[model samples]
Target: MKNSGEELHFRMDLGDSIEAREQSMISFYKRQRVDWTAPLTCTLEGDAAIGDGVKRHCLSSVMSKLQFGFEWKIGAGKTLLFEGEKDHLVPAASQVFVDSDLFVVAGRMIGHSFLHNGPCLTGLSQAVIHVLGGGMPEMASIDIEDCCDTDVREAVELLKGSAELTADQKRSIQSLASGWDLPGVTEENRRWLTEKILFHAVLSRSKGQVKQLRKGLKETQVLDLVTKRPDTLPLLFPRSCAVLYSPQLLLERIIWPAESDSGDETDDTSLEEKCRISGFLREYIENASSQCLQELLKFWHGWEVPPKELYVEVVHGLMPRSSTCMETLRLPSHYISYDAFREALNAAISSVPTGFGLV
Candidate 1:
């Protein structure tokens, strides 16, 4: 993705890459002109056994760190992000988020990923994206589903679901409201309380965190474009539709190996065998659920971000493996039937706990 034959190098380890990435970004930010447009060329340390770079293998590994909160090397680590309703990602509200400077790190990641044509942070709550893009908290269009905290969601539901509340429920609601300096639950203000609770759960609670995110985005200069053109939000933080990995999409992106130009009949049988295995993959993709589609994409190319093409090769091996650096899937042609192929691919995909590396 680097147009000028230029790439930046950083050392990373799978376990400590987040810390490594933080330092790398910190170094970049220290530069007088933080160039957001340049592509990242990363190489992993401690992965001498795994090795890095297919151009993408290490880059994907590092960029993958941008999506979630880093479990700090110090005490009481944080899971910077959590899933909300419909599995959209929303920032978690914790002092640790601010303390770790996750907002700053995440913004740089988003911008770098975007510019490098790597993964985009998909399925982010639209409301949160609005806030990160500099929309006011009060102006954020949030849904009850966007609130990831169970207690808060439940409290809001109870307030809205029934007029009468049990004593315990009432106290719970009051305590939650009190934490945010909102009014106690009363017959006359149920509507107001429900609204405020929803607001508090989604935006108010993360006010400082989101503020830092905006500051971070400004450092990347992505905020400058987002504020200037609201439509660009979908590119950085895409909605569900923009990220749907349909069977056809995957099938189309695949770059099948070219047939040998020589008229070697031996190559004919091997090409047939490869296509047969590919048939299994095609059928598997055809019926896969959205989650499975993502798993396959991740297995094939590191993160689920769609690439222009995914190079596929049939190999004489016992198992399937992918190189995100080269955007290639080395499929072992050992399986003779569809079920065997499916099972192998499934196991291979599951082995990667994170989308980028093997477990």
Candidate 2:
């Protein structure tokens, strides 16, 4: 039965990315005849050309939305979808997510995207990657930082290296532990309790989701590839979300506006400003920190996964703008110095911290 609550179309709302993709996956993923190798075709509801580029954009958009928007909550309504540091994230356990078949959608979506040469889901913890690649849960190395639940973290932190817990503290620790169906915390079982909580929070809770994801990969035939090669897992699910590019590397990716072949009188002056601004940009990127680079990429192409090239344009304006869909970066050609250029670039990226990909 088709889900009538939300209609699936190429011109779907970015905010409704989850619901839209979910409907489409549920409709198609189960069909054994669905060709994973077939090229994806997409178009807006209205008149528009449906091409591979739009298909690429669609896949990229889905995973990015899934990363930040489709998150579950923990204590105080804190998010617990992808836990651990910014660079290293593990899929957090959520009964709500599993029940909703979201993990299944995620797994299938990633496999579909991979078959089409789309984006990889970044920042996955090495521990989860091991299991995705067929490693046993017990042998997989776990970490304290990998736990997303603040309640668990606090309880474990309090119990670790403490001579004794105050009566109130012990009760608090025991209370939360009981919620996860864990036994009472004792001095003798403190280590056992901590390990159990961490494992449960990170893996045991998310086993079903992982299973569904692997099943999706199997349906897409990607699981067979990974199971046989075992080395291709990291390529599909890398550890870091940001790809650090050097100044030279980024500059090389710029597809600078070509000089006019016709002898237009304004061409010479336009080319001069383009050259000057490009120099200014090169200098700024040379000194740019990792955060700045990541932000710039988001501002340029919507996501940190660098495209093969970025189209650059020098426009007659005071601020910079980007069309993520077009992979184009438009800059004002009025800057006189590197410092002015750098300041404006920083301000532009910071202005839309939440939506760097938007114009």
Clashes of each: 4, 0
Tens-digit lDDT track of model 1 for 94-125: 67767867666667767666666667776788
Native RMSD of candidate 1 (Å): 4.5
Q: Report how far residue 137 has shifted in candidate 2, in Å.
A: 0.7
| Per-model TM against the reference | 0.77, 0.71
Per-residue lDDT over 222-309 for candidate 2, one digit per residue giving the tens place of the 0 to 100 score: 8888989888987788666344556776778888765662445554447788889878877888888776876687677755667899
TM-score for predicted model 1 compared with the true structure: 0.77
Cα lDDT, all candidates: 0.70, 0.69
Candidate 1 Cα misplacement greater than 4 A, ranges: 1-7, 14-34, 45-55, 62-78, 165-172, 255-271, 315-318, 321-326, 343-359
Each candidate: RMSD? 4.5, 6.2
**Per-residue lDDT of 196 in model 2:** 80
> After best superposition, candidate 1 residue 266: deviation in angstroms?
10
Evaluated against the true structure, the overall lDDT of model 2 is 0.69
